[model samples]
Target chain A: MAGNTTPTDFGNPVINWIDKRLPVFTMMQKEYGVFPTPRNFNYLWNFGAIAMVMLMVMIASGLVLAMHYTADTKLSFNVVERIMRDVDYGWLVRYIHMNGASMFFIAVYVHIFRGLYYGSYKQPRELLWILGVLILLLMMATAFMGYVLPWGQMSFWGATVITNLFSAIPLIGDTIVTWLWGGFSVDNPTLTRFFALHFLLPFVILGVVFLHIAALHVSGSNNPLGIEPKSDKDTVPFSPYYTVKDLFGVCVFLIIYAAFVFYAPNYMGHPDNYTPANPMVTPPHIVPEWYFLPFYAILRSFTIDIVIPFTDIIIISSKLGGVLLMFGSIAMMFILPWLDTSPVRSARFRPLYQKFFWLHLAVCITLGFMGAKPPEGIYTVISQICTFLYFAHYLIVLPLLNKYEKPLPLPPSIHEAILAQKK
Target chain B: MGNPHSHGAQCSHDAPQKHGQEECPDNGHDESKRDFIFISAASMAAVGTGVVAWPFVATLGPAKDTLALSTTEIDLSPIQEGQAVTVMWRGKPVFIRRRTAQDIELARKVDGDATAFNSLRDKQKDTDRVKQSTFGGKEMPQWLVMVGVCTHLGCVPMGQKPTDMRGDFDGWFCPCHGSHYDSAGRIRKGPAPHNLAVPTYTFLSENRIRIG
Candidate 1:
């Protein structure tokens, strides 16, 4: 059967004939125009649309930046300078692209948090949430590789530090790192490969995003109340309602993005990255981009080796433990759908779950703050505590909360909830 | 409260009629005027976006200026025996060491099976570390040239400074991760996976060398 089964009746004779044969317009109308969405979605629900807009903005600006970028280690830093100083409007494109990465992450984080608050990851939507997590992983990889293209002090050293992380693996670790670098070190070949993959992976993300949306359409969208649409009265067509809301969201996001691109372009960037890479001089502190700080904190927290009881026989070295914990933080997220045993979908109805959610947010922010600080004196102890809280919130608290917590009574319907709110 | 639902239903009911009336001249004239404004505004935005996107596409091609500076030639005449001079080549540090007779003897006496930690990366013999034993038809065993980056993580070895300790192996030592190399630049201990890499180079003369 054809994918587009909607009626082909465009009023125009020629358009109607074409729709009967090809049906692209029909599919668009069915999928986007008349697609049913719950009416109660709030401003937080707009982040998914905002994220999609940011992705497009990033790709457009990234394409323009790529046209002028030179991936060679020696020339990359200079070419970026040339783009700023010499090329026509290259400064605007580069700034937009540079700032676009931060905006993209910001939008995606909000989108993910929205899903968490509404329990959009529950049962039927598990695959949708999993696809989203995959997109996040791809984004991290893309951002990491994209950072290296400028060949700045941070870019070069960051690649060396992150890629060298593979060496913490057993016997074949060094070999795997070498294979990734395509040589003994991160050189021109590594840059070339990263550039190729960076150029490639956004398209792969776009494909995954397509699947993500298709999956969203199948199950429909979850709302603030976390209740399914039981009747036509509970839902509205996406076009006029969601399309107008999404447009307004995109416009507001663009204003903030434009501010960053124009006024405080380098606010999110490190000053060290302006200098060309010198392998001899390591930066005073090697920190990743601000978005990765929470995980970076987790990596630096494991300064003590795990020894078996009283014996000196090391179960895991500090170095290896750091590597595992850093990766495990993300790996834990992939399993969160299974970890949360709650029958209730929305945190708004679950009072106990809501309290832990706020605490979890605090732990994450604290971890991010600690990540940026030097791992010394009081900072290390705080980081260790925050890291413990982050894991415990997901692994222990979420499972336990699901079993014990009782949820508030739900409204009979969306209309009833709206009427109650009016009182 | 009921007005919103009624408004939505009215629009859905009007949708088929609106599609059917595309070519009709009897439709509201003000609606056509608003449609014209929307079309022009949208077209202008599209054009503006395209204009803004052009420079990024224009500047992405390969650069020719820096590629020309990839090779470097260093003079070895000023370098004394047991001294290593670092030269910049392709934006990396390359070490050119003029070995003393004592250094050469110590390097040659190093046992293959006992000292070499990871010899599999560069299988060349200690004698082969130098480009040619005889350059200009004379013995030139005192010179050893290598890219200065450590095999582990690209840090320059510390023993380039005379005051710096050469580790337990009595040669170049990388303080960053404790990788030690013998006088022949062979990896002998610590975390380095292989020897200091030998770059492609040629002796322009007895005292001159070109490295790419």
Candidate 2:
């Protein structure tokens, strides 16, 4: 009895440490109230809270990885191997970080699309949405640089190919390449620089996320109906309502994240990366990660050269065309709030707009899928058609539909919409 | 919380307030009910999708047996003089080359080499010193072996011939960046800050060797 009691007494410090450090259970009551979240919030509002949880998961796993990782080009790859092999549960930590990245992206994309679907970008909330977009771009940059640190064949060659793209600029392209490389080529300097940047950018993204949330809090959230709450009657406390919903979403997201961590870790990784970088032999096909495939497909799409008259200039290389199209795809999103001028906020109230919205979504997904596929005869033709439709839906159909479509009358309130549905 | 306007007996005649109060109570009850149904439905969908996403997520971890084979012992017997072969150790490229007379002479000679192979004199001396101290002069370089990774940007440097225009030093040249190195695998010129790392190895015989 004394032995067990003494052990429990000794464990008091650890328990006390955790209680003082986190205070999760107690703070959950004070700051959030017993059920703190705004009562009227729908499922769309859960994403922000879900994103916060993912950030914590990523940071915790990432810190564990950093403890074991060696940043040097020579030992970095080997060190990763050691961690996976020698360290207890190192593979679990690595899997969490890897899948955490994917899940983070998945959550962010949904959050952004939810904003788009609801016209949350309009007026007072524009800055909030824009900040979110900035966060996304920074996240992509951070992930891209991080992927190259492993010193695998793909990591090496991928860095080379991407850094070389700066050479596409006129006149000072070579200088830019050299400046980026810090030597004649991508070598130790490049690796060190990339590692430094990768370490730094995540913090920058964190800062931006803070700003995003601040902006969100100021403007409040747009609901499914895209209408602001008029009074206390329309609003609900944010704590209990949103906290519970977010918790549910998080548990569900983790289940999927766990599956990927355990079973098919290499499904997203290229086989060539298992081999260390070899300058003598180039892989048969150089491809970026799957996320970049759509843009890569667009870059490879054009076959014909558009020649400039008199000067004997050839314009529009397939690579350049594809690059332009990629930028065009993202730039199109900036104008969406304006392009989608339908009076009604919800798709439920606008039949024609809903049809076009679904069609556009399908086209985007198809284009992304096509982009991942090899640029063979049939795939190329299909991709081109999908690509054309992707742009056409935004540039042509949206503007035309905004002008012509008549939307059903919006219900007076959330309560009204619900009651009307019941009737 | 009673409203002052509705407290008076005369105000009880107002139909608007009576109707509003009647509807207000139902409104809270109605909204909560709707929220419950929506939240439950959404939760169910999220769970279903999450279940489906498991296999894709599980692929992110390393193989279960990977830790057992983390450290490997490689035999170096079949490597002939003036020949090289690559082997993977700890998931990195490890190149093993038997040095020829020409290779040794070129590596030692410091001057007139356009790429300045002499820059490695201090580095080579230091490595030699460390090897001597650690192994009591047991392991000397009759063979050259190293990780092929360029210290910069991680590109694999191509093996350079003596006549290559990038530099006269004949070890490897990285096409991605114009780094040059000597036959001893010392970085001579380029963006790379250090020489290629030499792995730990021991010769069992003139032909046989062991690397861990």
Among these predicted structures, which one has the highest DockQ? 1
Clashes of each: 5, 36
Q: For residues A1-423, what per-residue lDDT tens digits would candidate 1 score against the true structure?
A: 246396678899988888888887788888889998999989988899988888888889889888888888789899999999999999999999888999999999889888888899998999999999999999999999999999988898889878877877867887777667755557777898899989999999999999999999999999999888888888899999999999998899999999999999999999989988877655656678998889888887876656698655656756578789989988877898999968778898999988988898898889999888866668878988998998998899999987898899988888678778999
lDDT per residue (tens digit) for residues B70-149 in model 1: 67888899998778888877656788888889888787775455544223233457787887646768878788889887
TM-score of each: 0.71, 0.61
lDDT of 2 at A226: 65
Candidate 1, superposed: residue stretches over 4 Å from native: A1-4, A308-313, B1-212
Instruction: Please give the distance, in angstroms, between residue B71's alpha carbon in candidate 2 and its true position after superposition.
Output: 38
lDDT of 2 by residue, B68-171 (tens): 33444556677667767776664456677767778777765653453453334225532341123223445456567687665543456666332433344767
Off by over 4 Å in 2: A1-44, B1-212
Local accuracy of candidate 2 as per-residue lDDT tens digits, A249-297: 8888888778888987777768887777654554545567776666655
The fraction of reference interface contacts (C-alpha pairs within 8 A across chains A and B) present in each candidate is 0.05, 0.05
Candidate-wise lDDT, in order: 0.81, 0.66
